[model samples]
Target: MSAELAVVYAALILQDDQIEITSDKLQTLVKAAGIEVEPVWFSLYAKALAGQDLKALLLNVGAPGAGGAAAATGASGAAASTEAAVEEAVEEKEESDDDMGFGLFD
Candidate 1:
């Protein structure tokens, strides 16, 4: 896998195990896995995730129809709205492509 994907997988594992995901933790995981990635990527990942709810973000990611139902409920719903919006946006793009009389590959 790519370094970024490896880092994300490490973070997911840490989260699943109830460990805080941090640059140091990511570094240790990556090193233990025998992957050599640039230190800058770790810093970037840390910065990007700072002050964000990683669990919620992970839960909502790539889950299409369920996001709308989740968001319609309450505070836990807010994060899911992002996912729903993404799904709608993807649908819109696909519809627009159909209207254009050409496949994306064309």
Candidate 2:
């Protein structure tokens, strides 16, 4: 497996086993997998997640219909904002198609 994938797998294992996902734990898992990864990468990952709730983050990510359900559960305002963004993106794509200067029926 690629280095990044190995690291992710290690994190997943930690999550599954209800162990805290720490840089030390990540390093231990990676080493057990017989891969050499830079210590800085583990440190960075741990730092990035340090103040956040991993279970909530993971739930938001792994839940089905994540964009809708997760948004609904977390922040209604964010859900509305996300809807607006999707509509805007669709509108932009439609406008670009029109800019091509031809219609399928023509």
Candidate 3:
């Protein structure tokens, strides 16, 4: 699949945040991205963390809000984490940089 055509979505499940994104709704994206969801596609088995604090959880999960300390810590770690994720994503893509959509000249 072309890197430009891949579609990725991140989901953050928060307590009291009741929102459902059914497969039917996501089907178009999934299809366009050339991805197939397995039969057991959704995760419903993550236990709440107790006493570890939000900062620790964020660092582990690598979520922006979670990594910014329990309240507000430095953004260095979060920035590094984000950089790493972006690098990884770029590496995962098989297309050469030139294959990306943007034209060099209009």
TM-score of each: 0.56, 0.59, 0.24
> Who wins the lDDT comparison?
1
Name the lDDT of candidate 2. Answer: 0.79
Error of 3 at 25 (Å): 34
Q: lDDT per model, in order?
A: 0.82, 0.79, 0.43
Please identify model 1 stretches exceeding 4 Å from their true place.
Answer: 62-106
Candidate 2: segments with Cα more than 4 A from true spot: 62-100
Q: Would you list the rank order by lDDT, best first?
A: 1, 2, 3
User: In candidate 1, how many Å is residue 16 off?
Assistant: 1.1
Alpha-carbon shift of residue 96 in model 1 (angstroms) = 12
Best by TM-score: 2
Report the lDDT of model 3 for residue 12.
29
Query: When superposed on Cα atoms, how far off is each prediction in RMSD?
Result: 7.7, 5.0, 14.4
Off by over 4 Å in 3: 1-73, 95-106
